[model samples]
Target: MGSDGTTAEVRCVAAVPCWVSLMAHDLDVAKAFYGPLLGWEFEPGPDRFGPYVHAVTGGEAVAGLGAASGGWGMPVAWTSYFGTESADAAADAVRERGATLAVGPLSFDAGRVAFAADPAGAVFGIWEGPLGRARRLDLLGAPVWIELRTPDPFAAALFYGEVFRWDGRDPERFEVRWEHDRVVLRAEGHSVAALAREQAGGPAGLPPHWEVSFAVEDTDAALIRAEELGGTALGPAFDSPYGRVARLQDREGGRFAVISAKP
Candidate 1:
């Protein structure tokens, strides 16, 4: 199991494809938020239902985007799902770790998926790709980055280390790393992962949730669009060493990011 009690192998898988399943409160509003912000083009679902967002990077369908309806927690934020080879096996590993099963490893018409909460309380998705996934590492773009914030960095590392068996760089920033890449659960400041872990932890703290981000040409303009779209700005826009950032939440209560960075 992963350190948080999900599939360690799945979590550790390198080059795991990322796909965002947006559960938006208002589809039209979300379209407005992303269309101009990310320059995405809308297309039919092929067989999926409603409209599927075609994420373009140099004008290619690198990923799929779609609005989620229902669920009281639905909001206009991006939710990240990692690609796995076997949903059932991954789910089994997660269960073995004493994790909470929120949804299915069950079959969807399109694919197989399951939802679970880690020991840190961050909720994540596991997807078994029946067909395929996207083709990009795609930094400096929409929601291309992820950061983990955990209370017990060592515990977090131990959990994840067991799951993915990933090993990597000695972080200049975080404590431990997977494949020497991202410092697993070792961030000191505020980060999307930290925020999610806090949220997932609950009332006294923040709930763990994915903070989906969008590519914006102007952070101020994106914040303006956020207000117009019935999405609220969670905090002031700040400049990260990496870039400029603003936090946001939509009507249904999903949180995400809008970032503008220097070229």
Candidate 2:
């Protein structure tokens, strides 16, 4: 059991995004930036992945923060984690589907973990362990959505569908459908994520990546707070079909988004 009395053992539904993590150049700095902006507190997490902590809000783990030291030399970015029953098997599927397996299906105190990049070079992680009660997709300050910005949304969907067994999964709980120009993945009748074609060859163009969006009470207020905390608003808050959204970059150049909570 965890210190909070929650069971440390949880079998998360395989192939669903169970957690999200950010590797920052400095752990304290990341905490300081997010603490005030999102009303997040911190708690100790597994150190097997380096100095790591769980970002807690309302006594629930919303995200993870890790210090990007020890010659890791990776970019300071947020990587989304999908839950799996077998980390090694997922890693194998990643390789078989022509994706690059970057890290290990190594064992940690709570569970096994691995990292991989899709064919489009978008990096993501896999965890075979306790999800705790951190998988909140609607609560304020928790990750609400994850979007895949890639060259071809259809092809990307195909790749992920095979890797995660999205097609063969129980349809009542997990479903995928094409909505307009994007491919949407819904868990339990609610939209959890989407894949859309990325912008190309422009100043605003972003590389193929998975963008994580957090829930906020006020989009404009969050952007203002982000600037005051040394983060940049990559773009102004704009209303999407989902909600008012703003893209942001941390002081160290990690990109993420914030969306205002629905009434």
Which candidate has the top score in TM-score? 2
> CA shift at 61, candidate 2, in angstroms?
0.7
Off by over 4 Å in 1: 1-17, 46-57, 62-77, 108-110, 130-141, 165-205
Which lDDT value does model 2 have at 156? 87
Q: Backbone clashes per model, in order?
A: 18, 0
Candidate 2 lDDT over residue span 1-263, tens digit each: 57533432333556667678999998888988998998987778777668888887766777888995568777799999888778898899999988999999888776888999998888999899853332556678888888888888898888888778787777787889887478998887778789988754323466788889899999999999999999999877898767889999988888899998656
Root-mean-square deviation of every model: 8.2, 2.5
lDDT of 1 by residue, 1-263 (tens): 21222221112122232556665656666666656556665543322344444454444443355654435354354556656666777677777777776888876444687887667766677777543323333433445445444455455445544443334523432344333333433322222222222333543235544555655668777788778767788878888544577877765666677777646
> Scored by CA lDDT, what does every candidate get?
0.53, 0.81
Show pairs that collide, candidate 2: none
TM-score of 2: 0.92
Runs of candidate 2 exceeding 4 Å displacement: 1-11, 131-136, 200-203
